[model samples]
Target chain A: MSTGAVIEFTSISKRFGGVAAVKDLSFTVEPGRVTGFLGPNGAGKTTSLRILLGLVAASSGTATFGGVRYRDLPHPLKTVGAALEAASFHPGRTARDHLGVYAIAAGLPRTRVMEVLTLVGLAAHAAQRVGGYSLGMRQRLGLAYALLGDPGVLVLDEPINGLDPEGIRWIRGFLRDMAAEGRTVLVSSHLLSEVQQSVDDVVIIARGELVHLGPLSSLDTDAAPQTIVESPDREALAAALTAAGITFSIGRTGLLAATGDPALLGHLAFTAGVELSVLHRQKAGLEDSFLALVGGGHTL
Target chain B: MTMFLRSVSAEFAKIFTTRLWWILAIVLFGYIGLLAGGLAALFAGIQTGVISPDAVNTGGGPTDFGSLPPLIYSFASSVGYVFPVLLGALATTGEFRHQTLTPTFLATPRRGLVLGAKTVTLVLIGAGFGVVALAASVGIGGGVLSAFGVDALLQGAETWLLVARTLLAMGLWAAIGVGLGALVPNQVASIVIVLAFTQFVEPLLRLAASFLEVTAKIGNFLPGAASDALVGASVFTMASPAGTAPLDWWQGGLVLLGYALIATVIGYAVSWKRDVT
Candidate 1:
């Protein structure tokens, strides 16, 4: 990995017709980190990335690469490589020829095509037409294209969508390796668990608005742990917490609530004559933190 | 300059990588050869009194039997015109259709530069289509004409002039197609307009105007007519009413160029302002 340039989006907003697709969205992706841009469907993740790539115009604000606009980059491919989707390819073209077109446009030598294909593990299928490629293969080819410039900054949108578990693992490690080398990698995904494993930092958005932006660990994890307490007398446990002025919410198979320590809750339950069957601290993972910030759903 | 070269090279690779152009190339060659050969055989029958010359003239053919050879050769452009149009439309619209334009625009951020590169690349390939059309029409049609005892006139300077003009005309058709494709990136609609206008609608309009005194003059400015006047060998030239001199070759070239220029300019305007998404 190499030290990569910072990607800055300052107050970026994009409107389609009268609908506000992205409104006043602002964040910065720093060097040497794998940043996950997690958002729900229609949350403007793709739109923001498109604006950064200059594929779509921003209704307001600026997206800059190292403080330079993408269009103004002397050699764009050399600075930032982006893959919005795996299907943005010509089906009739073979993998090598498809990359060859970009190679020519970027003024890169033909050998770079093969190198990137090998990097993405598509070298064996390089001669095969993209029409015959499976969804996983197309995803690999898309990644191969993004890496063709050997760019310091990579922006991929839902790159893991069609990959198998092994391929997903490969990409997770690949992105980590890229960031480990100090290359800036911003991957947009709606899958919270997948992103949690792959990213060091996360910038989450909901309804086209920035929900939270910070390191993945900075997401409400250290504040206090949620305690899942189950009792033979569930109503007694709930009543005990309520009388004691400790708020509790009923959860599946338990009375769920957040507290500073499980020991305090355990002592309170014993004194209240609420026989506790289960009491344990539930560690908040990225998925839980993301759901807390963006609202509850199975995935971000 | 080097960037432009690279862009053009990419366009060439794009064209060759797909089976689209070569398939159209074969269509252009085979269609022109088959049509021109059939016309030569018809003229041979007319010369032998097997078919009435009057019958051919009524069907929008030349009245003078001697003009049939050049007319048939010039018909090569008429027969081969759609392929270039299809080629140009598919070249640009294929990008949008396949969503490959995202990467294309990403690789080369200047949209105008990308479009200009397409124009340059298509012109040469369009001219190459012209060469193929010319070869097939002359090779097959001339042989048929000679076998029928008509003077094929393959050696004449006029014959070569028609060939050169045919090449130029086909190139212009391709330029127009590129412009149209750019103007309307929708593949189905572009293909529809090209086929409907060039194949049937324009020819009917030309024939209808040829019958009138006032409208005949205005019809000369039509793209198909201008292209025919440029080539100096359209079947419409014979059908044109007497005493009205159609546009000279130079004027016809300008008119054809004007359409390409207008279409491209407007296409560029829309493309420059619109988002690719």
Candidate 2:
């Protein structure tokens, strides 16, 4: 297996007319892991990926693969395989012919076409024209195209957008396997839930700027732990919580205490002689933290 | 060199795998065949006294029997050039229409190299279209002329030279199509410009220009006129007044090349290197 290369974007900025699409965005994706380039819709995820692949010009800074610009890479296809959009195929050409064109252009052997088709589970449909492909199949074909050169790095944009549950599961495992083989995989998606299980590291952007970048577990750490408590007598429960100096707020279901341990809240209620009805700690889901960091509930 | 050749080979595969090229080829063949054959029959009949010249119009076609064969063959370039242009334009525009340029550029990052490969491939395919067109015009048109007992001039060296030049003209027309395609890049707009100009605009301009000596001098340099001049014969050119002569064949070829060069250069500067996403 070819070793993966580190991808870096340094102060990359792209402006379209008066609007800045990507503003001073900087991040690095290391090898031997899958990095989820996560953001809400129109967060410049696609624009940033395009710049990294040399499909778009950055107004400032550089996006390079292993310190070399994508355009200057001697064997670009073999070094960095990119699939920017799933629908970027000619409808009239068969899947085989579509891959065949790139294979010949990239100077790869014809046998690699079949190899990738089988790899992506599209071998049976290779002869069929792309016009007849479903959205899921097109996504698979796009992945097959990316794998055509067996490059060390893979860049995919919205790869799982239309995949079925099974395909999504398969791709998750496939991405892990690729990472296991030490290939740097950067997959972009607007939703954290879609890639939360698959990715090891997360690079979250919002409004054309980097909002968070760290390991997947680190996102949840930023979310403060809370416990939900309720009682048949809401007045006593609220008083007990306030008297104990525990910060609490009223929610539709109960009083939300700022503490994570349900035991502490239960003990406090017992001492205050408050008739408790509900008490449980709320697990801070990565999705919630992601939404909070991006500064909106609209993303949900 | 190897990279360029591989890119060229990939371009050829891109064209052949689709049905559009052959569909346009069939249309070109039939359109040119019917025109050349029909005109041959009418002109040959008038020449042989089988039909009255007054029946068709006020006057007759070229009374020079020696020029009839080349004139029929010239239809391959004169009328059939549109198909290659359309084919070339479609080939480039479709990349933008379908967003295939993303993958194409991914495979070959050098944008200029990709455009050059496309031009080279389209030129060759355009020459191939020229061959199919010539086959129709020569086969049917020559048969019609021979049936009227006129010398079809199939064996003459001059007739073959016209055929060779027609091939070159078709190839250049295809290059011009690529240039136009790169310049416009929008499929519908490029196609509209091609049809509107080839079918209506240039024809009207050429006709209006033919009446004035000063305008006629400039009109001779027009793409269609230059094409006819390069081919050495066109039914359209036969009607021009005596004083307005077509440019030398080589000069016409240079003028056609100049258009392709200008379009390609401007297009490369304006849009070809721009961001695709």
DockQ of each: 0.81, 0.86
State how far residue B272 of model 1 sits from its true place (Å). 5.2
Give the per-residue lDDT digits (tens) of candidate 2, residues A1-300.
Answer: 457999999999999999999999999999999999988888899999999999899999999999999999988889987877888989999999999999999999999999999999999999999999999999999999999989999999989999999999999999999999999999999888899889999999998999999999998873588899999998998898889899988898998899988998899889989899999998888888888888777563
Tens digits of per-residue lDDT for model 1, B1-277: 8889989999999999989888989888888899889877886778766677766655664445566678888877866878887898888878888998899988999888898899888888988999999888888888888887888898899999989988888888888888998799899999999999988999889888877778889998999899888888766676666536789988988898899889988988876347877
Query: Per-residue error at A102 for model 2, in Å?
Result: 0.9
TM-score of 1: 0.92
Report candidate 2's interface RMSD in Å. Answer: 0.5
Candidate 2 ranges with C-alpha deviation above 4 Å: A230-247, A250-254, A268-278, A298-300, B60-66
Q: Which runs in model 1 stand beyond 4 Å of their true positions?
A: A1-3, A221-224, A229-260, A263-279, A295-300, B48-63, B241-243
User: Which of the numbered candidates is closest to the native, going by highest lDDT?
Assistant: 2
Query: Native contacts recovered by candidate 2, as a share?
Result: 0.87
Q: After superposition, how far is residue A288 of candidate 1 from its true place, in Å?
A: 3.6
RMSD of each: 3.0, 2.0
Best by DockQ: 2
